[model samples]
Target chain A: MADTTTGQSLGAERTTEIQDAYMAMTRTKRMYGGIMLIVFIALMVSGFMLADSRNAGGFWDGILNIFNFPGEVLKEAGEKITLLPALMVKFFPSLVETINIAAASTLIGGLLAIVLSLLSTRGLARFPRLIGVFRRLMDILRAIPEIVVALVLIFVLGGGPVPAMIAIALHTAGALGKLFSEINENASLKPLEGLESTGATWSQRMLLGVVPQVAPNWLSYALLRFEINIRASAILGFVGSGGIGYDLKNAFSWGQGRYDEVAAIFILLFLTIVFFDQLSSHYRNKLVGKA
Target chain B: MTATAETLPITDLKQSATALIGRKRLLAFATPVVIAAYFVYLFFAFDIPGLVDRARMDNAAILVADSYSYKTHVTHDNRGGGLGFAIEGENKGTYPEGMLPEFVTRTGEDAVDIALKAGESATIEGSTLRYTRPDYGTVTVAVEGRDIILDTPDGTVPDWISASGARVNITGAGGRAVVTRARTEVYRYSMGWELFWFTLDSPFYGKSFGELAGLAFSGERVVADKSNLAAMVHDFWNNAMWRHKDVIWAIFETVLMAFLGTMGAALIALPLAFLAARNFTRLMSVRFAVRRFFDFVRGVDGLIWTIILSRAFGPGPMTGALAILITDSGSFGKMFSEALENVDDKQIEGVTSTGAKPLQRYRFGVIPQVTPVFLSQILYYLESNTRSATVIGAITGGGIGLLLTQAIITQKDWEEVSYYIVLVILMVIAMDWFSGWLRGKLIGRSE
Candidate 1:
């Protein structure tokens, strides 16, 4: 009876010790979390201050006047609301050019991305030793902001839609290549092995066996990229390439009397983005859901 | 009875299969046809033919050449009767008196001999300039009374030599020489960026690598006030031609924008996600409103948001950050809420069974499950936002993008443009590696 009581007490003491250690760990973790939070807060505050000091206008002053430009634009647009439709019609072709740039880039970029992804993918790579080279190439291609390419091309090719198209296409290829390779990794190798056993060429195997498996995901990604490219192409246009964004910039620079045109372009952009955003999301949902 | 039922289902499947094949065939042919037609239309619309005519191959050649090479200008002022040597003929790049490159030698009081590449040589004597090329005989140019006279060995100039009553230009494989009534100049092209590490004024400007190493290790101070290494660093950092200090600051500012933007967006989106999540907010109206708000924000797009926020915050890193923050918040909100909805109910149930409060339950159960997903998304955006920040910086007149645009705008600073491009590429790749590393550390590597 005495030995049993002592053993029970010893077990009880060990359990209490473990409980104390767990509580201590929890407290230490909370302390670290608190410290991290404080540090993050400090960084944000200081960064904001530094940015404010470097700015042309103070944040507080600018915020107060923030609505001034937009309000003026809205007022003018409201007054000339009748002209808005005609302005939209005038800029519609430019908008079409922007869309075309996006579509063309997506098509071209998607094609290149397919080749690049296959080249970089482990089992699918034709020259596996050069996979690092291809991967780095894609990284560089993706790293280059479209504006950099567009601006440089503008210098070489002159201001036009082609520069923007090429820039967006190059970026899309790199961006999509990375994502596509990820999908390619998950693809079942059974079909690939079967095709290879039948003496199928690499391209044939990829086309017949692998492409079917990943097509849906690739298409879905390409559609999403198209939506993104549209926005990118528009922005590139603002930087001096040709599109509705260029028209918007012209109208914006004119100020006051041209607010109607700006408003029209803004409406078109907003509506188009929303429409494509919804459409792509809906299709992506169906595609992923079915899979 | 079983056979009939099975046959009926098999017939249905066969019919559907045939129909699907037919549709697929139609789509296969129609899609390409449509795409081809669109391309044909685009070819005309974009004016592919006219682009060829509009393209300036000469400008492209100059850009390509200038990006990798620099020229030293040797000039004799006809009016002032003075000799000047400069790199790219810029005032900042002018050599000090009595200081000249090795290729140029002062032969006499009023004469200098320039040793061009490939056995080509040029001599400047008072008002006369003579160039000798191995492939071509000597050509003499004289500036006299508001006119340039060119005397070739054959009395007939080749296509590479362009002469007018007022000016003469001799272009050869080795170098170029131009003589006008006002001045006579010879340009010697050489490989590599000129004075990249050190300028002419620095004590270590033209030192060999071995010498530099020795100086860095044990030599006396290069400057009177500082150590040799410090002086070297100071000179490199303050290099007037490259502006390394400014470039580094700009890079930092770009990263700052991305960090502030991504973190701020995540912080804002986390709470807003709860309101939009169907499982979290019991009120349907609140959820609908928040979801719609996210859609609206996302629809406006980053470009519009940038414009709007720049108006409010003015041009700087802060404006770019805010634009990124506002736009990405919508994305994060939608993604976060979806993640929230997909959370396993058992974890939350266990926490609730412990008599934990709602906040405690979320903190202990929901946050942990979603943290990895949230972190991965945030880090991915942080990488991409670096690139966006560059573009946004271009629009806002800040960061390396501004420097790049400015350099390109100058139309002659292709070297600087190339430099900026290299730096920007390196910055982006670094960010990519960094974010990937962080993601791997935070969440186990996927591959």
Candidate 2:
């Protein structure tokens, strides 16, 4: 009975020791986390101050006046609300041009992306030795911002939708190529081997064997890209290209009397973007779910 | 009866299969045909043939040539009767008096001989300029009174030479010379970026690499106030032509915008995500409102946000950061809520069983479970936002984008444009590599 009592005591002491060690560990961890949090907060504060100092207007001053421009715009838009419909109608052709730019670029870029993805994917490349070359080409294309290309092209070709289209298409090709190649890597290669055994050409094999399996995912990605391209096209137009954004810039730059036009454009752009966003998400969910 | 039923089902199956195959084949052909038709329509819509005429090939040629090569201008001011030599004819690139490039030799007080490539040499003396081409012999251009006269060995100006009474421009394989009544200018083209490290004012300018290395390591003070190495670095950093310091700062500002924007978005989105997540928030009204807010923010778009913020902030990196933050918060909110909804409940249950309070449960259970997903998404967005920040910067007037646009708008600064483009590309690639590395380090290599 004494020995049993002693054993129980010994077990209790060990449990207390273990608990103390665990508590110490937890304390150390919490202290480390606290220090990290403090450092992060410090970094964020300093960074914010630095950015604020570099800005043209002070943040505190700017914040107070944040609503001034919007208020003026809203007041003007409200007074000339009757002209909104007419302005929208006038900008409809510009909107169509913007959409066409997006659509054409998406289509062309999608096609190029397909070829690039196929050429760069491992175990499926038509020229295995050139896989790295194609991959690097995609990287370079992806790294270049669309504005750089658009501005350069605008210089040579003058300001137009074509420059925006070509610029967006090049970027999309690179962006989509990387994603498509990843999807290609996940696709089954057995069908490709079977096609090759049947003496099918490289293109024939890709079409008959590999493309069917990856088409749904590719289509989904392409749809998403189309939505992004629309935004890019509009932004490019603002920079100096032909589209609704150019009209909006003109209206906005006019400052006061043309706020109605700006308001109408903002409405149109907002609606179009939301519509495409919803449509593409719906299609993407359906594609991925069904697949 | 069994055999008949089986045969009937087989025939039905075969018919359906054949129909499916026929539809597939038709689609296969129709898709490409539709695309081709659209391309044909676009060809006319974009006016491809008209573009051929409208396109400025000379501007493109100049852009390409200027990006790779720089020209030295040897000019004599006829009105002032003084000679000056400058690189690219810019005041900043003017050579100091009595100091000239090896190719240029001062023969007299107002005369200098410029050695061009391919055995071509040009001597500018007062108002008269003489160019000697190995194959074309000698061409003399004199600016006398109001009329500029040009005389070639053949007495007939070739197509390469465009001469008028006021201005005479002679273009040759070696170099180009322009003689006007006000000034006679000779351009000698050279390869590579000149004065990239030091300007004419610096003593270290035009030093050979070996000499520079020797000076750097010898611990001598080239400039009185500073050591040779320090002076070299200071000169390089403050290079007026390259603007390296400003360029670096711009790059940093670009990255800072991305960093602040992405992290700020993630922080703001996290709490909002809890409200939006179906499993976390039981109130339907709250969830609906939050989701709609996310949609509204996203639908407004970054370009619109950038414009709005720039109006308020008056054009800076902060406005860009805010624009990115607002747009990305919408995206992060949606993605984070989805990730939260997908979190396994088992961990939460275990934490609850440990007698952990609600806040502790979340800290120990929910956050740890979703951290990897959160981190990976945030990192990915960080990389993408770097690119977006460049675009936004252009609109808001900050960062390297501002410099790039400024350079491009000048139309003559194609070299600077190319330089900025290369830097932007390198910055993006570096960001990509950094994000990938962080993703691997923080979340392991899932791929």
Candidate 3:
């Protein structure tokens, strides 16, 4: 009876020791987290201040006046509501051009990305030794912002949709290459091995074996990239490449009298983006859901 | 009856298999055809032929050459009777009276000798300029009254020389010389960016690295008020031509905008996400409204947001930050809600079983579970938003993008444009690496 009581006391002592050690650990973790949070908050606040001081307009003042421009645009747009449809129609060709740029670039970039991703993937690489080179090449391509390329091309090619298309294509290739390669990593290699045993060529193996496995996911990603490219094309236009954004810039720069046209373009852009966003998301969900 | 049923099932399986294969085959061929057709349509629609015609190959060549090489202009003003040496003909790069490029030497009050590349030489004396090339012989240009005269050895002007009544231009393999009524200017091309370290006004301008190092360590200060190193740093930072200080600040502002926008959005969306989550919110109407709000904001897109915000805020990083914040809040809200819905119910139930209040339960259960996922997503967006910020900055007139656009617009500053491009690329890559590293440290590389 005495020994049993001693054993119970020993159990209680070990449990207390364990509890104390756990509490100490938790306390240290909490303290470290607190320190990190404090540092982060400090950085954020100081960064905001520096940005504000450097900015042309103060944030507090700007916040109060945020709706002024929008209100004016809306009021003007409201007055000339009937012209909105005609203005949208007038800008429809430019919008189509923008969509075409996105589409053509996505197709071309998707093709390039497939080749690049296949070459970089570990199990599927034809020349495994050159995989790093291909990967770095993609990194450089990705690292270059599309506007940089578009602006330079604009200087060379003059204002046109081709430069925007080429710029967005290059960027899309790089971005999709990285993502597609990740997808390639998850793909099973059994098909490739089977093809290899059959004495199939590298291209043949890729087409017949690997592409079949990854095509749906690749298409889904390509669709998402298409949506992104549309936005990029529009932006490139605003910066002087050529699209609806160029038209928007023209109208916006004309100031107060043209707010109706601006509203029209805004609505068209918003609608197109939403339509594509919904379409791509729906398809993406279906593709991934099946997987 | 059993045999008939068995045969029917086998044949049905075979028919379905064949149909599937046929559909796949049709899709394979049709996809490429459609793509090719689309390309054909685009080729005509984008006016590829016109683009080829509109393309300025000369401009491309100039951009390529100017990005790496700089030209020094040696000018002799005929009317004013003044001579000046300038790099790229810019006032900021004007050479002091005593200092000139090694190949250029003053011969008389208004006369100068310029040594061009490949044994070509030019001399400006009085109102006459003479250029001698090994293969092209000698070309003399004289500015007289309002008319410029050109004389070649053969008395036959080659296509390389363009002469008019008021101006005579000689373009040779070595350099270019123009004699006009106002001034006689000779341009000599040299490799590499000049005045990148110090301008002519700085005392440290012509010193070699070794000499500069010695000056830095020497006790004798170059300037009376400051140390040599401090002066050097100050000159380099405030370099009028390159504006290194401004460039650095612009890069910082871009990153700051991105950080503020991304983190601010994540903070704003976290609570909103709980309300949007199906399990957390009971009111269907509330959930529908929130979801629709998220969609509406996201659909408006960053470009429109930037335009609208810049109109009110008037071109700055704050506007860019807010634009990103507003656009990304929608994304974060949707993504975070999805993440919240996927959270394990058992953990929340366990917290509640401990007699924890709603807030405490969330703190102990929900936050811990979602923190890693949320943090990774935020970091990813932070990196991406840095790039977006550069684009938005261009629209909003803030950050490195503003500098880049300004440089590109100048057209003559191709070297500066290239420099900015390099810096922007480096900044993006560095941000990418830093965010990836942080994400890895904070959360295991799940995404």
Tell me, by DockQ, which candidate is best: 3
lDDT of 2 at B323: 90
lDDT of 1 by residue, A1-291 (tens): 999999999999999999999999999989988998899899999988987787777878987887888888899999999998998899999999999999999999998999999999999999999999999999889999999899988988988899999999999999999999999998999999999999999999999888989989999999999999999998899878999889988987787798888889999999999999989889998887754
What 10-residue stretch in candidate 3 chain B is worst by lDDT?
B438-447
The C-alpha stretches of model 1 lying farther than 4 A from their native spots are B1-13
Task: Write candidate 3's Cα lDDT for A180-222 as tens digits.
Answer: 9999998899998899999999999999998988988998999
Interface RMSD of 3: 0.9
Task: Please give the RMSD of candidate 1 to the true structure.
Answer: 2.0
lDDT by residue (B47-83, candidate 3, tens digit) is 9989999999999999999999999999998998988
What TM-score results for chain B when candidate 1 is compared with the true chain B? Answer: 0.96
What's the DockQ of model 1? 0.74
Model 2 has fnat of: 0.69
Candidate of highest lDDT? 3
The alpha-carbon deviation from the true structure for residue A193 of candidate 2, after best TM-score superposition, in angstroms, is: 1.5
> Which residue pairs clash within candidate 1?
none
Local distance difference test scores for all models: 0.91, 0.91, 0.92
lDDT score of residue B2 within candidate 3: 92
Q: For candidate 1, what is the DockQ-based docking class?
A: medium
lDDT of 1 by residue, B181-249 (tens): 889999999999988888887778889989988988986776897888898899989988778899899
Q: Is model 2 an incorrect, acceptable, medium or high docking prediction?
A: medium
